[model samples]
Target: MGEGRLFESIGRALGLPPEAVARFGVDGPAEAAVLVETALRASGFRTDVTLYIDASRARALTSVEVATRVAPLLGEEVLVSPPADDPAVATSWFLITPGGERFRAREASPGNDSDCVEIDRASLRPG
Candidate 1:
């Protein structure tokens, strides 16, 4: 799952105010996923993601997204997930790529889904 602390981390890295993020009506953890995606993509990197849906928590016809974390830690890819047991959980992601290909990846997880945002992980971190 996308940890709120991660969002806070992205906020600082992306140079966005947490209040502006808070205004998005992202109350629980689900919305936090979207917020994390938006902030990361807006930071100007090609991002990609895969979303998993539990179907039980979705209120409307929601799409999939990436459950975000530090992803892959040392690779170009990262995996994101939240506990399936969490009620306000997010299981999908809006993947962003340098080529503008925003779609889901053909993968499934009963947990935090996967990365919906792609950063130059190789450039951003060490192996």
Candidate 2:
């Protein structure tokens, strides 16, 4: 999907406003060109999104930094998962919904690794 459409879909799924969704692509055009794999779950849509940040900047980007930037955007009601011992790991944070559903978010991979945030639909229900 096109970047704009992709962000729109994500916003709809997560119940984020347009301005909030725009943060994902704040870096640049290429920043929003994330690899997204979506599935239809019994609750709703679940999406795994891998963001591609600029390699030059990614070298200094830590998982904590990525999480810090993302968590607040998900809103105050969402709970964040604990951090790993190593701050550089791709798996940084898991966003827990009010319904107790979990979704993961991480920093961009240094190599060709396909890591991303797994966003469960805002309407997700506890199973």
Candidate 3:
């Protein structure tokens, strides 16, 4: 799928508005997308979504910036991880809802050999 469409699909899964998702690709396109499902927490289980954007063409915004900007729209408290100095390493960041739903974001290239857990598109829908 095209980058725009991919972002839109991700936005819907995250329950984000189209405008908010558009900000992700303002400077560059997202090269890859992945959705992961982990064991249920004490609160509940939420699908974790990650997208890799071309850093060279994207803005240097931090995870805090992105989470804070999107939190208000979702009416939830979003937390972020500490920044990483190296670009080659995965800087983990998470968006957690009041209900304990967690969303993680990471920076990586599409060609990276890291194994990503894949799920069908239908799984993106809210359960």
Candidate 4:
């Protein structure tokens, strides 16, 4: 589906007009984070994404499961790293979410602005 349609659905799910959600399409990473958070809340799940950070620098955005919902809208395939994987190296394991969003779950050092944000594994568990 086209990017406009995808955000429209997400916006509808969040009780917002398509125009509102469509705005995020051209927005930055911060908008993507807001999109995920909005979708998770609309799904009737907890919105608290905290308490899952493994390291002081592990930036937990949403859970793997929550992200799964957005994955379909992103594209055909989404790659998520297993929780058991070792901490990330400069060149190491990573997850590629829908829309080509790539990130590592753990990192030895602070990530740059271009790196992907981590998610909590516990967020993937079925309730």
Q: Report the number of the highest-TM-score candidate.
A: 3
Cα lDDT, all candidates: 0.34, 0.41, 0.42, 0.39
Q: Would you estimate the TM-scores of all the predictions?
A: 0.23, 0.30, 0.34, 0.29
CA deviation > 4 Å runs, candidate 4:
9-17, 24-66, 73-75, 79-86, 89-127
lDDT winner:
3
Q: Which ten residues in a row have the lowest lDDT in candidate 3?
A: 36-45
Residue 89, model 3: lDDT of: 36
**Candidate 2 residue runs with Cα over 4 Å from true position:** 1-45, 57-59, 76-127
Q: Write the residue-wise lDDT of candidate 1 on 1-127 in tens digits.
A: 2445445433443344443233133363444322323234432223433332234432222221222222322222343333355442463333333233343332333244243333333232111
Regions of model 3 farther than 4 Å from truth: 1-47, 85-127
Instruction: Name the lDDT of candidate 4.
Output: 0.39
Displacement of residue 20 (Cα, Å) in model 4 is 3.3
lDDT of 3 by residue, 18-60 (tens): 4444433345333323222222222211223344433454444
Better of 1 and 4 by TM-score: 4
Please provide, for model 4 over 84-111, each residue's C-alpha lDDT reduced to its tens digit, 9 standing for 90 to 100. Answer: 4444333333444566455544333334
For model 4, name the residue pairs that clash. Answer: none
Give the TM-score ranking, best first.
Answer: 3, 2, 4, 1
The order of the candidates by lDDT, greatest first, is 3, 2, 4, 1
Worst 10 residues of 2 by lDDT: 37-46
lDDT of 2 by residue, 8-99 (tens): 54444444443334434335343332323333223212333444433443334443344444434443223244456646334444555434
